[model samples]
Structures are given as structure tokens and as C-alpha cells.
Target chain A: MTALPPKLQDYLDDFSFITTREERADFLIDIADSFQPVPARVASKPYDEAHRVIGCESEAFVWAVERADGRLDYYFDVLNPQGLSAMAMSAILDEACSGAPLEQVANISGDVVFAFFGRDISMGKGRGLTELINAVVYHARQRL
Target chain B: MSDIKSRGYANADKLVSTDWVAAHLNDTGVRIIESNEDPLLYPSGHLPGAVEVDWVKDLNDPLRRDYLDRAGFEALAGRIGISPETTVIFYGDKSNWWATYALWVFELFGHTNAKIMDGGRLKWAEEGRELTREKPDIGPTSYTAPERDDSQVRAFRDGVLAHIEAGGQLVDVRSPGEFSGETLHMPGYPQEGAVRGGHIPGASSVPWSRAANEDGTFKNAAELRAIYLDEIGLNPEEPTIAYCRIGERSSHTWFVLTNLLGFGDVRNYDGSWTEWGNSVGLPIEK
Candidate 1:
């Protein structure tokens, strides 16, 4: 385990502002509002090549950039019409892990990410969070 | 999709047009409920008079593995500004998937006055309808809870198994791959899926999408009849139970069978494959 990256720490800092499930959900919505969609070509690739995120409610793909400083940068593409929450989760990971140390990204736990939902999110939604975290961790570890 | 009225539903009033909603935007007795597959859609922009009702938050019981208790149902209705006499019109995205899901819950609480918007949000947008970011602040009212009637339209796992045991008609309203055990859940929605795949024994595979046109509105009665009554050979007089993963999609078929075609006995097995696939010793059809 490594020291928590500043950006990941910043996300945890902001987590205090989200007390209600709606607020936590709204935070993800805000992430969706700022998310960029994948290019047409990249989106059409096969799952293996697309780096598909298994276990999401939608087809999500990730690409990580390992910088000279040993930090990881992430870009995500989610292929589901109703996958706003997954996109938001990708955006959160993008901010938290991108440019952060690889060790920090690898160490970030799924539980802590969904703690935003305050133990009240649906069982299905809880799995969605875990899947997203698992995707991020899988990508980070592979890069590591 | 053609005019929904052409199909001649037993209660055609259950399907209202976007124009009807527009005309009744400020009408006190009509409470517009918007529940979407994507929870964030309401905040982005929605029908001016609609209040958001989440399937998970408002419909489910907090502690139990079931829907809200009798008092909780009444409180939820009142909290959402719905009274007994109010006509609840539902509409949302993903072809009104969550909208139908919410309407089914309303039916569980015996709110027969409920309705669905024809073509849902897609058709509304396709027809150049208006959307606003304004959220309505309607006053809460006293909504009396109807008696908990789980028998009429909802089917638990036990009832589903018994129906199978008794050689009853069961519709597995899931995708072909899921019915074949090739996929666990809808592509991307992995969380709602069970540990294993395949459907209950003796259940016919008729994906819920077959009941709807491409735009997400219900197909005409003739098309649905060809699928359900003719193709699947289900008798309208006998009871039919429909199930999907976690029960949302099946409600679409439940709405189609019970309301559209006038089937007197159709129940939505809400626990669905998630429950069935997890239970050990439960026979898996595939």
C-alpha cells in the first residue's frame, strides 16, 4: 500500500459533503454532466480490445496511461443508454486515479467509493459500484 | 408505433398521450410521476409538473426484501403528493422501463387509477415536446393505503415454482442469451444478474421487448397476440406469471398482458431470476 494520492484524498474530502443517498447520486450525476463520450471507432471495438470492464450494468471500457512519474491516467467509455451512473463512476475514478500514483489507484478500495451512498444504495447499485472499482483496480494492477 | 388506442386495451385510459399530459400540467387531480432507468435524467430536464419517484427508494421496504409495508405505501404516496383520487401518469427514459416499473408498484398497492404515457419520454421528445428543469413543489395529501393485495398481479418465487409444478403458464421475459444461459444480465447491467443463468423450468422465453415497438411503446394488440396467445399458446383465461431479472422488465409484459390484452390473471414475479438462480436445489430449466 502507498500513501493516498492528493486527488484521491480530495475526493474523500468532498465525500463529507454528501450525506444523503440523493446527494451521493447527485455527485455522480455531476460527474456525468462533465463526462466525454468515446469516439465512434473506439466504441465499436471488440470487448477484449476495448478493455471492457466486466460486471458493470453497462459495457464499460478503460485505457490507462502510465506516466514517467509512475502515475496512472484513465479514460473510460461506457456503452449503455442508461449507464449514467457508470459514466459518473468512471469520471470519479478519472479524477481520483488519473495522474495519481499507480500504487494509490491500486490501493483504493471499492467500499470507500460506494461509502458515498451511505449504506443505502440498492443491492444492484452496490454491485455496480464494486464492478467499477474492480475495473479500475484491474486496469491499475495490469498497468503496474 | 401506431395509436395505442387502436389496440383496444381493456382500460385504454391507462395509456395517455403527451398532449393529455400537456393539457393537464396544472390539473390538481393528475399527479405526473417520472421514474427513469437513469436516475439523473429528472434533474437534467423533465416534464414541468412531474415528481421523481425512484423504484428503489420509494417503492421498496427499507428492511424487508419486499415492497413497502401498508403504512409505508400510504406515506410514500402522500409524500409524493398523490391522493386516492389522483390519476397518476407515469413516463420516463429507456422507453419508460422504470416508468412501467413504478406503475407496477403502484398497482401492487392497488392504485388502479394509475396510467402510462404513450411512447414515454422518447416519443415525447421525438414529437418535439418541451422539457424543463423546473421541479414542482406540490403539497402533500392524505393518501389512504389500499389493502396489501399481492395475489392479483405480483408473484413471489414460491408461487412461481408452484405454478411451474402445476404446469401453469410462465413467461421468461428475458433475452435469448439469458434464456439460454449464455448471458447473466443485460450487457452492462451485471449487478442485477444472479450467480448462474438459465430460466425456470417450463417457462416460455418471450423477451419483454417483443411486446414493444422499436420506439419503446407497446406494439399493437395483433402483434402481441401473435406472440403471447398464438406463438406462445398461452390462454388468457388461465393465470400467467411473467418474470425477468429483478422483475422490472417483466412488469412491461405484465402491463401488456393484464391491461392491454385484458388478461384477467397475470402476475409479475418481481424477485425474478436473481432469486431463482441463487436458491440451491431449485431446479434450473436450462
Candidate 2:
């Protein structure tokens, strides 16, 4: 099996130790606070529908720019200001998948959302965040 | 947009504005509660002295497909430091969808002193109000809650079937796609989808979000009347039932019809499409 993105695996490892919802929430909130949206150089308002993450209620958009070494740099924007979970997931994807091996990034499972956000997230939220992951993976698969 | 009272709601007192909440932040008789679809929202930042009540964890029964029981609710009430007489003001994300839902649950246990914060968290943030990450130090109150009385404000599957048989008014507060059977669930929510699509027969399609303005506040009474009473021709005197996937969105509509428009009787079918669409032998209309 192809190895997972090292940074992503580390995050999952860190989350695996989360024994309380409060701990998980605090960690995710911090991550969301660090989230930076896609720079204007990559995209802007009224983003192309092609980059929009399907099934995301957060109205998140994803862009995968190909680096010179054939790796990919992922950038994202979640339109809903209250969509902090989406923002955190986007930040994680940007940090973990960007410039990572295309094959590894493509192989990342959408279930990583459950790992990060936990099992208790509402069904709608879980699905939307999963779709955000799928959007990033779609770009990686397109490159491969 | 205007003062909540000036918006001409049938029950103007049911909703409080952000300014009211700010003024009442330190009022011992009132408790500010935030309930949201996103669990991260409350912990990140919230109204000062506000407590977070998660719909999934606080309001729901862990083992069953139902809400928390009387004992559970009492425990939650005590945990939140609210007495029967304490006025509860609920606010949250998703246009206060989950906030109204929490209020509905509290009502089931006879906590009638509940009100919603208009425009919810979005408006509060937009208005540049203070949001703090600090969790309030609340003293636990000994709350004695009555048994949950679902007959008044809640509808079961059998109750819904009989209601439809009796030609009771129903509102399908899902997206047009879901109401029309074009989609099994709201876009991006396939996991909550059912085996069958389409709304209950004789149900009017009014997406719950229509009740709200662009800023997430409820539309003035006249605009809301145009949609529910004028467009759909629903009589305010008639009994109504509103349902969406799992009944969270419908709670918003239930609040509108029951409180805003003064509909005499309205019940939210919390089982909703998840139960109806999946249940065997149930009739569905596209």
C-alpha cells in the first residue's frame, strides 16, 4: 500500500490520542484559526464552478496547482464564515497534501474527516467535509 | 433589519435582537445558550457568558432514535444552570436552525420561557459584537423538568399518516429538489438520504430558509405571510406539520408558523424523511 502523506499521518496520530470532545474541539479550532484562504494569485471571488467542492454546504472551493517537481500545492476557500470545520480541513489538506507525492495525496481517504472531526459531527457536516477531501483528491488524481 | 417588534410578528416577543442579548448578558434571570450544527463554533468563539448545547450530544438520546428523556433533560438543565423560571435565549449558526431546534426541545419539557436570538451567530459576528472564547463559570441549578410532552409540538409517523388522512396541512421544508423527488437528501447529505425520495402527499414545498432574510433574520410578518398564507393558502387557524430531514430545519419553520404567524397549532415531525422515506409501507408523493 502507498504511504499516507507524512504530515497527514502525523495529524491522525495526534488525533488518535484525543480522549475528550473538548480536547478535539480546541485542537480543531486552533487549526481553523490558522487557516489561510487561497491567495488572489491562485483564485478570487466568484470562483469558477469547476473548483467548487461538490456537496459542501460550507461552499468551499479547492485549487491544486502543479509544482515544478510534479507535486501539487492545494489551496482552499470556505465561503461561509461559520464553516470553521471546513476551514480547518482545508488548512490540513493544504499543509499535508501540498507538494506531497501525487500518488500518496490521491490515496488519502475521505474518512480522515471522521478521524479529525470525530464521529459525532452531524451527517450533513460529515458529508460536506468528506466531499472537501474528495475535491482535493480529485485534483491529485487528475494530475496522475 | 428593523427592531424585532417593529417587524410586525404575531408574537414579537418570541425573538430577541443582538442588542437585547448584549443588554441581558449579566441578567441573572436569563441564560444565553448557543446551539449550532457545527460543534467547533461554540468553542472557537461565542457571545459572552453564553453556554453551548450541542444538538447531537445534549438534546438527543444516545441509544435511541429520539430526544433525551425527562431525566436526561433535567440533568442537562441543571448542567447548564437553568431553572424552570429562567428565561433562555438561544442563538447559533445556520440561520438559527439548530437554535430553534434546541428551543423546541426545551419546550417539549415545558420550558416555555424560551426565545430565539434573531439572525443568530452570523448577525452577531457581522455586527461586530463581542465574542469570547471563555467558558462561563456557571453554578449548577437543581432543575426538575416535567416529562417530555411530544403530543403538542411533535408528530410521530402514525400521527402524520392520520393527519394527512384528515387533510391536515403539511409543509415540506426541504430543498425543492428533495420535495420534488429529484434528490433523496439535501445536496451533499447522501448519508442521511432515504430509500425513497419525494415529500409526503399534500405537503407544501417551502424551503425553511425562505423565512429568513439575507442577514439570517426572519422576514417581516408581511413577507412571511406572502409565502405561507398567500402563496400556499394555508389558513392560520388550521393545524400544520412541518418536516425536513431529521426535523432540524423544520424546527425553524415550526417557529415561524407557530410564533411568527400565530398559527394556532403546528407540530414538527422530528422523525421526518429519515423515517418516512425509509419506512416500509409508507406512501410517498413526488
Candidate 2 lDDT, tens digit per residue, B117-207? 9999999999999999999999999999889999899999999999999999999999999999899888778745688989999999999
Q: Largest DockQ belongs to which candidate?
A: 2
Tens digits of per-residue lDDT, candidate 1, B95-183, equal 77788989998887888899999878877877777887677887888888877889788998788888999999999998898998888
- DockQ for each candidate? 0.32, 0.91
Error of 1 at B157 (Å): 4.3
Off by over 4 Å in 2: none
Give TM-scores of chain A for all candidates: 0.81, 0.98
Candidate 2 scores a C-alpha RMSD against the true structure in Å of 0.9
Off by over 4 Å in 1: A38-59, A65-72, A78-82, A123-130, B7-10, B125-128, B181-197, B277-283
Q: For each candidate, how many residue pairs have backbone atoms clashing (under 3 Å)?
A: 4, 0
Instruction: Name the best candidate (by TM-score).
Output: 2
* Residue B113 lDDT, candidate 2, scale 0-100: 96
Model 1 misses residue A32 by how many Å? 2.6
Deviation of model 1 at A81, angstroms: 5.9
